[model samples]
Every structure is written in structure tokens, then in C-alpha cells.
Target: MSLVNRRRRPPAINIVPLVDVLTVLLFFFLVTMQFKQVSVLNITVPKIETAGKNEIKEQILIAVSAEGEFFYNDRPVDKEQLEGLVQLAGDTTPDMPVLLIADEDAPLKHVTLVMDLCRSHRLNKLRLQSR
Candidate 1:
């Protein structure tokens, strides 16, 4: 046999398939992802002695901070817009109770304003948030 050596082919690395698979997975996850907003109402509910036991659902939660900032379902609302906001939420869940969750240090007037909104909307099943 001749002493001359033949050139060997370089090893091949195929990344096309890997890249395609990764792209497909990315698209799948993007399309299947669910978008939902879960608003949290941080509050210290007032304690009560004569409160009754009841099942509450679809309640419109209102929150007030210590600074007297008003929030309905975690969204800030101007005093002028209070009525419309409460009415809209109550209308959506007509039978649901209106729950007011106010901070312990919140002004009594702020808490009272929320109660007033609920009362004006004719919401009977009002509940206060508590620790």
C-alpha cells in the first residue's frame, strides 16, 4: 500500500434541529400561557362581637390605606367616581356582598365613606375585612 494518507472529513455538528425544537417549544408556551389578574386587598378587618356566620361570594372588595387613599378592588378611585364604581361592581355581581377592607390606621372617615357607598347602592350584605 502507498504511504500517502487520505484526508479525513471533519466531524459535523447539526444545530438546525435543536434550534427548530427550541423555537417550537417557545411558541407553544407563549400561546398556552394564561393571563389573569388577581388583585390583592391588604387590610385589617374590624373585629365584631355580634357578626353572623354566612357564606359570601363574588363580593366587591374595597380597601382604604392609612393615608386615607380609597381603593376599590385594588384600583384607586376618586371620591367623585365612587358611586359609579360601586354601582358597576355591584351590578356585575348583583347578589354578592360588598366587603370593605380597611387598614387599622385608616381614618374613620375613609372607612365610613366605603360604608356609605355600599349603603347607597342598597347593598345589604356588607362585610368588613379583618386580620
Candidate 2:
């Protein structure tokens, strides 16, 4: 028999060990994973992937357009209407965060007005939603 033609062991790989290790890692991650409750109010924001990321409790969102229009939770409201809404939210949850999302072309006075309104309600946990 030729030296190179003798019995040669076929190359093989054992995948059982790899599968076992992967399963163990999956279980470890699952055990350590934390699931959070997303609030219904979260759906109102547009393309806001990271807004109020660290805020666990439901927050109040105040949006200002470039035309100095005020929107509370996506509903167009006047200053007095916004005040009532803010007061209601603030009274219900004292520690709720207020997220301010303003257009780039929006006037500074509109932003200031919303900020002032939030402060009046004693909703001090404020966050400016920005990219």
C-alpha cells in the first residue's frame, strides 16, 4: 500500500459542544435580562427612539411648532388649555418628567412659555427632547 494511500481519518468537527455552550449563554442572558413596561402614552411621539430613555414613569410631553403652536400629548391646545392639562398631570404625578420637544424654527418664547408652565405646576423633572 502506498504511504499516502493508507487509511486516513476524515476531517470532522463536533458541534455538540458549541451548541451546548450557546444554549448556556442564552439561558444566562435570559436570566439576567430585565423587561420593562412601556407606557401607552409613548405612542404619541414621532420617531422618538431615545426620548426620556431613563424615565421609568409616564411623562408629560409638550410639543411646540414653529408657528408658536402648543401641543399637549399631540392635541393642539391654547395656553389656557395647556395649563389645565399640565396642572392635571402634575397634580396626579408629582414626580412625572416633562419632555419638551420643540421645532428648530420654533420661537424661543414658545419654548420658554411651556417651560414656565411646567414649572408653575411644580413638575420639576424636566427633560428637553433633542437628537
Best by lDDT: 2
Q: For model 1, state the Cα shift of residue 46 in Å.
A: 4.9
Give per-model TM-scores. Answer: 0.57, 0.58
What Cα-based lDDT does every candidate model obtain? 0.76, 0.79
List, residue by residue over 8-116, the lDDT tens digit for candidate 2: 8899999999999999999999999998643333223334656545554577778888788888877789989999999998888878888887877778898898898
Model 1 agreement with the true structure over 63-105: per-residue lDDT tens digits: 8887887887788877767779887766665566887778888
Give the least accurate 10-residue stretch of model 2, judged by summed lDDT. 37-46
Q: Over 4 Å off in model 2, which ranges?
A: 1-57
| Model 2: residue 76 alpha-carbon error in angstroms | 1.0
Assess the local accuracy of residue 120 in candidate 2 as a C-alpha lDDT between 0 and 100.
Answer: 86
lDDT for 53 in candidate 1 is: 55
